[model samples]
Target: MTRITMREAISQAMWEEMERDPDVFILGEEVGVWGGSYAVTKGFYDHFGEKRVRDTPISESTIVGAAIGSALTGLRPIAEIMTINFAFSAMDHIVNQAAKLHYMFGGQLILPLVIRTVGGGGRQLGATHSQTPDAIFAHFPGLKVVAPGTPEDAKGLLKSAIRSNDPIFFIEHATLYQTRAEVPDGDYITPIGKSKVHREGRDVTIVTYSKMLETSSKAAEQLSGMGIEAEIIDLRTLRPLDMEPVLESFRKTNRAVIVEEGWRSYGVGAEVTARIYEEAFDYVDAPIQRVAQKEVPLPYNRTLEQLALPQVEDVVQAVKEVL
Candidate 1:
């Protein structure tokens, strides 16, 4: 095993996939020459040549539309939307067209494309840029949503997204790119729609995904001091939520505390909580708790931003309340 940062892991996944398949190509603003907005795809253009690593204008709609068009024509396209805030401009191409293409065209066409974007609030990118819009894309059918929390999962899940036949919305938290972890040496794909239990416990289940996994893990450590063993489930794929593992964990710990950086109203936690209440109602020993952002635009102030977003202590307190 080799330790690598999430940015390096993501680059390796796309590089390996591009080298493995000729059909795989990348395009987006600042991707080819600028190495992507956050430098995630740095050095890709020089290595893959200009054709494979083409750059486009600063148009999210055009980039996603071209990818969708290329996908229908049997070319595997990987496009980046710069940020989650900018993706709203391409919702028509992303939701109305690419998402419905596979089923809308019967079983003839398989739209294999990936839209990579970044979102998180640590840098205080203001209210618009810091929005976690994964919940919106996950709401639409025929689209796979993936948000890996670590280097290992980032590498593995990116490879899988590149090879998947359906359209995939790949979200990378801005603050998690530099996080280091041990990744496998050879080719490996972390199966999407599968939840991984990061910790074992008998008290409460802390179901979370993406960057929130870090906050949840820290809370778990603090909760351990209080004799509370919080089981952490990273829902790496938000679309096809892997609730089986969650249900099994719920059987071990009859309470839950769902967490997200997005708003509490109709967020990812809301969907997962509904599933728990519907499928595992009898197994639940208490009202399902949630730790999420306050229902307001993320403020520019550092202190206010941190307060709006769910913190480690917030999760710990929520778990205590559930217990």
Candidate 2:
């Protein structure tokens, strides 16, 4: 095992996948010459050449459409959209085409495409580039949504998404790119539709993904010091969610708190809370609590933005309320 940053792990995954499968290629703006906006694809253009690591115009819709077209014809394409907020421009292709192609064709076509993008706010990127769209894609029937928190999960989940037969919307946290963790040397893949218990406890269950997972973990640590043990469950894959671990945790703890960086209304946490209530309501000893961002346009001020988003303290308070 070796320690590496999330950004390096992601790049390594792409490089290894490209080396192993000739069908796997990357396409997006600044992906080649610029080495990707976050430098995740740094040096990839030279390594893979322009044929495989091709760069395109600044058009999200066209990029997604081309990826879908190539995927239908047997080429596994990884489409980088730069940011989740920009993906709104290409919703038609991502929602209607890339997602529904297989089911629409009655399983005739295998859309093995991975849509990679950075999401969440921590760098003060303003409102335009900082929205978390995991819930949006999760709501759709045919899309596989993944939000990995740690460097290991980022690498393993990306590899799995690239190999899967369905289209995967792989959401990465912008702030976690530089976070380092130990990763396995050999090729390995973390299965989709699986949840991992990040930190186990018996007092309360905190369900979250992506950046919120880090927040929840920190909150759990703080809660531990206060005699309130909280278990953290990382929902690696949002779509086709593996609820077994969540239900199991809820059964043991009988209290729950869902943490998400997105807005509260209709967010991924809402879905999780609803699912828990429906499946394990009788087992729950208290009402499920949801910790999420404020329902207002993200402010430009750094302090205001931080206030608007869910913090570690917010998660702790929510857990206490539920307990």
Clashing pairs in 1: none
lDDT of 2 by residue, 174-264 (tens): 9999889899998999998899999989999999999998899899889999998898999999998999999999999999999999998
Instruction: List candidate 2 segments past 4 Å from native.
Output: none
Write model 1 residue lDDT over 162-228, tens digit each, in one string.
9998899999999998899899999999998899998899899999999999999999999999888
Worst 10 residues of 1 by lDDT: 101-110
Q: Which candidate is the best by lDDT?
A: 2
Candidate 1 ranges with C-alpha deviation above 4 Å: none
